[model samples]
Target: MSPLKSYLDLYKHLPQTNCKKCGMAACLAFAAAAMRGQKLLSACPDLAPQVREELARELGQAADPQEELTRAMAPLKARVAAVDLAAKAGQLGCTHNGKRLVLKCLGKDFTVDPDGSLASQCHVNAWLAEPMLNYVSLGQGKDPLGRWKLLRELPGGEDWHRLFGQRCEKPLQKVIDEHRDLMEWVIDIFGAQAVEEEGSAELRVVLWPLPKLPLLIRYWPPEDGMESTLNLCFDATATDNLPIESIYTLGVGLVTMLEKIALTHDT
Candidate 1:
């Protein structure tokens, strides 16, 4: 069987229902995953049996997330190569270094080479690199309006909210509940700003993962039989600065980082 060419090709075969049953926000997301071998076409129960069988035979097997991420990066990198980094520096709040565009990420300098390669004083991963490249290449670079909204409120974000809560907020809340000091440590280490909000949340901080994309994390400690809770909110213009998928990746990435830090401190 021949391999699928692109996500769009796979998308054409989907039910286009935007159902969340497959753990993805939409059929398009599932299609992308299917094409990358991260998910099987049969995962979508809505798919016709014959269609599922045909796709299963064609796709061969599902690749792990890391393998899928690596494959997805190639086209994104090519798009980045066509971008004029210098021209976008001002809009993106980056510095044009003649040969690269440098931007501050999580308080660390991340330099993007003209060829779309990334270098940072801190560790780099596909999760971070993919979003950064998307921001540099496709971001409208609109400034945050200081208005905050939940992930579901952003354009095309409704379908993704549940998965975001499951993969990002819930896990981070567990870490914060276990290590309360981790919040302050993240603020100090990542150059995040502590903010006051009228709520039960014991701690709140805003992290600028991208110049125009600010994420606010609020943690409410358990009290009076209530369990601890955490919620991640974003600027209303966040979708303009990064796609919904990239935003989800960013949240998951941040949570993963915090989990590592908490583990290290515990040891």
Candidate 2:
């Protein structure tokens, strides 16, 4: 078999579900990341058999995303060992239990041990674990400023805005556009709150995906021959509490959750 020539070549062989199962917003996003060596072909759980065969032929089988997450956790876990969870409890909006810090994550309780290992009743994903680890190890612990800003406006976010939009906002807009009651599900299930921005009546929801990292989502229904649109924003001080990458991870995770809900509704 010939070597993979480009991202499009990689994309053409994907399952094409845009399932977001590999922690990317779309299959194309996964293909792009894989092409860049930031992701693995094995990350997609639904890779077609022929695609997997081609990869094993040329690339000799790659570690899956879970294995990659486990590898990524090592350094972050080591850093947590040096942190005093008790001292950081207040700033990080967590409760310390001598060796572990307990905090609410996506409306559920998650605990971080001294070694940065995470535990919760809810099923954990790398999308959640990476951000939670960064929050514990490197977070500056700044409180939300209430003012909102695009990811591009954040200090390290300019380079990530486009990918963030593609991965988070656009997928969410599609879900909401197709399933209107998904908003009620967000409000009732995830405890998202409806918020009116300034003086406008635009439909918006505020959710705490992490304690100090709140997210704002606004959706505009289709009107006057225009397509429906959605926008996602972070608190002005968002990067103060989590790295820009972590912020992006949090949004991707949120989209994954919404997609699950939408799938459930469909079935």
Candidate 3:
């Protein structure tokens, strides 16, 4: 059997009922997990026997998470090799240093070579590399409109909103709750700016993860028996500069970085 080439292919075989029986909130999420080899086809009890057998044959063998990420990033890297870095720099409001395209990522200068190889003082990993490549290859170079909106408000964002919250906002909120100085550290380390917005939030900080992709994070401290809340918003033109998946990836990446920093400080 041929291996499944994409998540959508795996998703089509699922029940699509958005039933949480598989431990994933939606069938789409389950499919994504399966593609990443984090979940097995048989884990979805609702799957028909025939479909399970077919998927088992087509999926070949489950790969480790690192291997899955490498496999998924292969195509994006190939595409990056085909793009002219200097040309993309102009289109994406980046600077080219003759050998690489430089863009501001989380206020740090990130450089990408023509072969999709990335370099920065910050950590580099498949998660960040994939999105950076996508931005260079597909981003439309739209200027941020300054109007902030929730991720769900972006085109095609509704389906991803739940996962985004679980993977990005909730985890980041936990980090902040545990480390009282986290918000201030992010502002200082990432060059984030504290912005005053008309809201009940006790703190609001704006960060530029990409040149045109600015993220606004708001934190509402616990009050009146209510738990604290953290929300992430982006410029309305975010999707125009990077696809929704890249946006989600960037958010998760940022949180992961902060989590590591917090851990180091705790140690």
Give the Cα lDDT of each candidate. Answer: 0.83, 0.81, 0.81
Structural similarity to truth (TM-score) of each candidate: 0.80, 0.77, 0.78
Top candidate on lDDT is: 1
Model 2, runs deviating above 4 Å: 1-65, 197-201
For each of the candidates, the C-alpha root-mean-square deviation to the true structure, in angstroms, is 4.9, 5.7, 5.3
Best by TM-score: 1
Clash number for each model: 1, 0, 0
Superposed Cα deviation of residue 246, candidate 1 (Å): 1.2
lDDT per residue, candidate 2, 1-267, as tens digits?
558788887787788987665767688988887776566676687986676767745544444546656655677788888899889888898898777899897688889887778999888877778788888888888988899998989988876778788889999999998999878877887777888768774788999888888998988989899998889999998988888877888888889888888999988
Which regions in candidate 1 have their CA more than 4 angstroms from the true location?
A: 1-29, 32-69, 197-201
**Model 1 TM-score (2 dp):** 0.80
Candidate 3 accuracy as TM-score: 0.78
